[model samples]
Target: MSMLAGATLVASTLLGAGPASAARPPQAPAIPVAGLADPPAEFGTDWHDPLTAAPPVTHPTGKSCEVTVAEAQFRDFTPYKGTYAPPRGCGDRWSKVVLRLDGKVQGRQYDRLGYLHIGGVEVLRTSTPQPSPDGIEWSVEKDVTRYGDTFREGHDVEMLIGNVVDDTYTGIIDVKVTLTFYPAEKPAATKTATKTVAKAAAAPDHVLTLQDGTLTTPRNSERIVAEVYATGSGGGCEEYWYLTVPDAAPYSCKAGDGPYREVQIEVDGKLAGIAAPFPTVWTGGWSNPFLWYVIPGPRAFDIKPVEYDLTPFAGLLNDGRPHRIDVSVVGVPEGQSGWSTPVNVLVWQDAKSTRVTGKLTAHRAGDLTNSSTYTSGSEHRLDTGAGHRLTVAGYVDTSHGRVTTTVDRELAATSVHRWTDGESTDALKGTWTDDEKVTVDGHGPAVTTRTDRTYTMDGATTLGAGDRLRTVLSLGDRASVVETRGGRRTAWSRLDDSYAGDATYTANVPRDQRHAVGTTSERYRLYGSDGCYDRRLVTVQGTLTGVRDSC
Candidate 1:
């Protein structure tokens, strides 16, 4: 079957729902239908299964093997623990590794966050979709080849999807995770001269996890990178940190510094890296679960970690001593706990050298700029703007010679939130941009890579006549990257992912009587030196109506 046809089949089968009604009476007949249909809508026993337009993991063509990592049903705080062993037939070195998680849930349930860890290295951080009464099944795949080092050995695995299963909320999250590995191809034996393909860089030599907020790297570490799975959650205000207001403002969620939040990494009491966290909206976000019954927000299913090039600090951490390495979310209220930051450090060692020495040549951090103004009136408004910049440079004496690396990062965000008294109508429009540049000057010519990232959210929720609530939202995630050698562009890539939805339902009503109606769509386009991919998905009520591939 075609991709679109397959998607439609899956949506129908998984949701276990019927076709949407064409003509139905609206709760408030006087309110003219504005681009949306009336309710007694499609939502019956279930809705369209959750899905995204992101590209799937491409498997390599070679001998392969699969291993089941974890299988369990999560209903509370308890986690699933098991042992993970490498595939038997697959060799230690793999050309590619893919991790896939399949999950199913039925009955009523709220969106819950989850994670998977092997040997204490976090490999996946995801969130579940609010389930339909009948049930729904979804899957997510990620290319985990970078964590090859962690998978080569037998290690303990832990997985959790914190949830509550009571009489009212009866969904139990059932999940099974597996890994597939493909062996590397042998080099061709040819006497004749042939074009050579540059082999991709090897995976990290070691994957190290933090111990009590401290890190210890290999003495001969030549290159180091740190990835942090930072999330603002705990079913509290931090989950909606972007919409928070200052303490003086009359709002449900309050942050002393307003809605501006930045994720920062510190090493030995000094700033190492800074980043803007992506504003992720769960399936039930904005008080409208119908908006996401078919399509979720960007990065909602597969949460990508904030990466930092920590090679500059390799010298400081290579002393064979545990150094204090901390991750913190700025702008959170003091003494409040709602953020989870689990760190994984990847290290590349100097194979030919027993020990490598280096020094941090430069470290500079500009003052943080944050401003939030609140205006009180019939429509209360809060406006905020924040930014920060950091630059670090260092050199390591490797077996190949001296290698100098420099990293620069900048983050900026602006948001405007407006709401009526008692939050009868709430609206927010926000944008965040993160730009980073890395330069490496070694034995050969200097090479530089620049990446620019942008995220946007424009959404509003309003309560109207007959206790009918409506939400209209649009979200965007875009990025562009360029690699230059000696000031000449060698490679470039661009990505644009956007989502929009309009949904409405009766407020404070039983699940079956809410009369929810929604229309959601997503368009994902990615182009790079390798190739191009573009796909669009649309859903009305609970059925997948459109799935188009333009590229």
Candidate 2:
């Protein structure tokens, strides 16, 4: 669960899957990014040894089964459905499906989670990863491949392992589930020829709930978007909203108490791509299960509507001219002014795809000037000799401490492709010895490797304003790891939406090596504070938690 394969193909669809075949038909699906080719057909944990007796079974796709349940009384519950059918004519070659789960749960107590239905919906959901380091195993994966039309309509795909962990609590909960199919006989969708630029009718898209959220336009596309919906009003730490393509800009700032933020994309301006901001499918009211986790997925929904890819700057948005697509937001929601957060500014033009030439030399971006100190550094470069060559440097030093608001954002990036969604945040309201360091590098031989990284977050938090105060939160991640490139081993694997450790790759990182680089939490709340009380701190996947509303 080192952040669970850094998964974040969040709603992806371009479809591609057509390789690997012993004549195909073993159920097919190994979700290796889908297109298929090599081996691609894996299942783990000896095919479900003791999963918890079930009431469903119809294997065929890489057949493997098991279900067992011994006891449970207190907060008792059960929902272990099943389904695996894929030997028919193969619905338009469906193309895409990957569901992996390695298990090991010898409970000291209990509290389970798992659900990955197919047509009956429920897409994918998991939570049994936290074992590793000798305590047995733990693995997880989900790329439902958009259901492949509910597995070509055969239906029945289900998986629900449940346990509330109460009723005096009984133990035992083991799991293993696998599905890999990337079929494509005649269908796989990948046309390409889009051109939907729009957002000028005086800047459309609304529902900011209160105020301050804008999206400008001048437009030229290759995929430039700013679809927003962050609803947590009153959370700040510089309060962000930026996206300029002309002189390079990409920011979606957040100090923490997150509803799961992260939305940055700047191509001509440098840093291209980073998406994470879509939740809010529904949010009725009363919520404070200790601040908030209203639990149930998408990080508990804040209002949904999140989509950001920027198409890797689509060659800096194809220079056919026209360019000004701005977006603004300053402490929206909860900071006052009614608190609204909604903005939609999209552009997607992939006419035929190539026509590249780049230059983005932003060597600095740390200017809060009189707002109370700031200084950022950069050294960007992007060449597209048919594509592949992106070097980005980094430096940041922020200070505005009285109560606390210090930041240090040192980043590095090299690209030969492979930089999706986004995740890089560091906010400290005060004291980490003041925290400040910089020197991050980047080199991308087509995603080859070269990342000299240095941007750390140690830990700190304190709150109390009276009215029976009680809101203690502590966050830690003594940041450390690689800062070199070349060869086939670069550390800093993948931990989207939250900076600070939880690697996977293996690029060789020994620079300032410091493990346990993240995930060291401590939270306690009691909010009736009456006046001042707002929060923010996220790093879910590497740990470091704290999300707002404490009373």
In terms of lDDT, the best-performing candidate is 1
In candidate 2, position 274 carries an lDDT of 33
Residue 34's lDDT within candidate 1 is 40
lDDT of 1 by residue, 1-551 (tens): 00001021111111111111101111111212242333334677866678887666656555899999999999999999999999998888776678899999999888999999999999999999888889999998877877888988999999999999999899999999999988755556653212111122346788899888889898999999888898888778888888989999988888898999999999998999999998988887888888887689988888888889988987887889999998999999899988999999988899899999999999999999999999999999999999999999999999999999999999999999998888888899999999999999999889888888899999998889998998999999988777788898776767788999998888877777788888899988766654566788778887777777766
Evaluate residue 295 in candidate 2 and report its C-alpha lDDT on the 0 to 100 scale: 20
Please identify model 1 stretches exceeding 4 Å from their true place: 1-41, 188-201
Q: For residues 258-314, write the lDDT of model 2, one tens digit per residue.
A: 111233434334443333222221111111011111121222211233334333333
Error of 2 at 190 (Å): 18
How many backbone collisions does model 1 have?
Answer: 0
Superposed by TM-score, candidate 1 places the C-alpha of residue 189 at a distance from the truth, in angstroms, of 4.9
For model 2, the stretches where C-alpha displacement exceeds 4 angstroms are 1-94, 102-106, 109-126, 129-141, 144-177, 187-262, 268-307, 316-551
Best by TM-score: 1
- For model 2, what is the alpha-carbon lDDT of residue 476? 27
